[model samples]
Target: MSRLYSDIFTNRASTGQASADLSEAHPKFAVNKVDFWYPGKQALYNISLTIPERSVVAFIGPSGCGKSTLLRVLNRMNDLIDGTRHTGDVNLDGKNIFAPEVNLVDLRRRVGMVFQKSNPFPKSIYENVVFGPRVAGQRDRARLDYLVERCLKQSALWNEVKDRLHTSALALSGGQQQRLCIARALATDPEVLLMDEPASALDPKSTNAIEDLIFELKKDYTIVIVTHNMQQAARVSDVTAFFFEGKLVESGLTEKIFTRPTQRQTEDYITGRFG
Candidate 1:
């Protein structure tokens, strides 16, 4: 009874197409008329969206507007909640991830995630970075060493922590720990990275580092982030999706979404009239 994501696809049966940015290039992930319910309350309603490959997309809205809920849906994290029910399709590379045949472990490995606060394992820094590969049966120490270095470098944390690889991960600052988490996610060579407020708990300097890392990571991994910082979304994401009351009010290029949203609801929220 593993969890599932978008695993089925059908145009007529689909109910959550929010906007028309579906170009010829198949989206890395597609949310088609997705509706979610938790017990008696509906957290999301008819939400349709698409994520392209090798790009950074941001989900922004007031708290409880389903920004993070939808983010969780990407990796099937929501499935862990009791009495939660979902409909519609969430397609990754045109395959509905919810299909029974889909391997949740493999899906999680390919679609890695970072959370709002750093949650490094209580282990050595080197161990933290190599844990994923090591668990999958990687025992060659030289190969493990190379993987750790490469992943940490990709996450921009190799330089600062190289001298302390054997130190407890909990000893690092909040930013370094978060980057270590990112490095750990990268160790598996995931094609997509999901970040749920990856910088909200850090200082300004740490936030900037995470933002910079996002910029660099976009070249190799398709990224989606849920953020409360509008400015941070603008700075780090190429596309933005604005959610209101669990519905996708508007989505488009970051510039257009910020500067010229066609929907009045989007304008009101973005302009500070209301959230």
Candidate 2:
């Protein structure tokens, strides 16, 4: 049954202007008829969506609804898991990201990801932010230092951590650690940032901090976030996509999805009627 629906969605995604216009508008990241499987169980249906450039698009859905799966597919993070299979096209700025000729290292550099849990390196706050640029062959101290400050400020952590840049990232609170992780992701100067429930574990205050950072960062980088919090989605995203049972139930402007959803399932889920 899942496969049948996947095929139908894939067909519709491929034979229409949805994919084309998505690329036209964003030209940063485009997923067309995307499908994924883990050892024979389909995890994502033909999920097609366009992420507008320098904008935040939030994915909201119940547990096991494939929100995280879809976010990982955008940056090919699923490839890290064993026995994972994927089909269809994901383009970054009009280039096929899944192409054999594409360099995984470079692709990851362009498309950075922040996981649900904050996993900062054991190194100091300064080291975590400069790690990516160093690995990318940036050897100049001046350039690395400049990037470190820029990224930390961009992630809204510079003012808090600047005085102790040499302090270990692990020494910070959970929220600070997450922001450090975000700074690390930004250090690479990625064109697209994929976040999976980035603030799910933080306190309300910390969550607000992250939310504000997302709102501000969208001015420079395109962001795709998977979040279970409906209000957070409404607050941070310009577009909202509702997923259920591995399918894209509906998507549109955030206001529309929250206040006037077109699908009954979407309305129900948004209004606390059902999962």
Best by lDDT: 1
- What clash pairs does model 2 have? none
What shift in Å separates residue 115 of candidate 1 from its native position after superposition? 0.5
lDDT of 2 by residue, 1-275 (tens): 22432343354356441122233465577789988899879988898887788778899999999999888887788899999998889888888888989998888888899989999999999999989888888899999889989999998899999899998899999999999999999999888899999999999999989987887787788899999887677667778899998989898867557766789888888777887
Residues 1-275 of candidate 1 have per-residue lDDT tens digits of: 00111111121125332222425545899999999988989999999998888778999999999989999899898888999989999999999999999998899998999999899999999999999998889999999999999999999999999998999999999999999999999998899999999999999999989988897888789999999887777677777999988999999877678767899888788767887
Q: All candidates' TM-scores?
A: 0.90, 0.89
Clashes of 1: 10
Stretches of model 1 off by over 4 angstroms after superposition: 1-26
Best by TM-score, which number?
1
The lDDT of model 1 is: 0.86
Clashes of 2: 0
Count of clashes, each model: 10, 0
Window of ten residues with lowest summed lDDT in model 1: 1-10
Give the Cα error of residue 169 in candidate 2, in Å: 1.2
- Assess the local accuracy of residue 230 in candidate 1 as a C-alpha lDDT between 0 and 100: 75
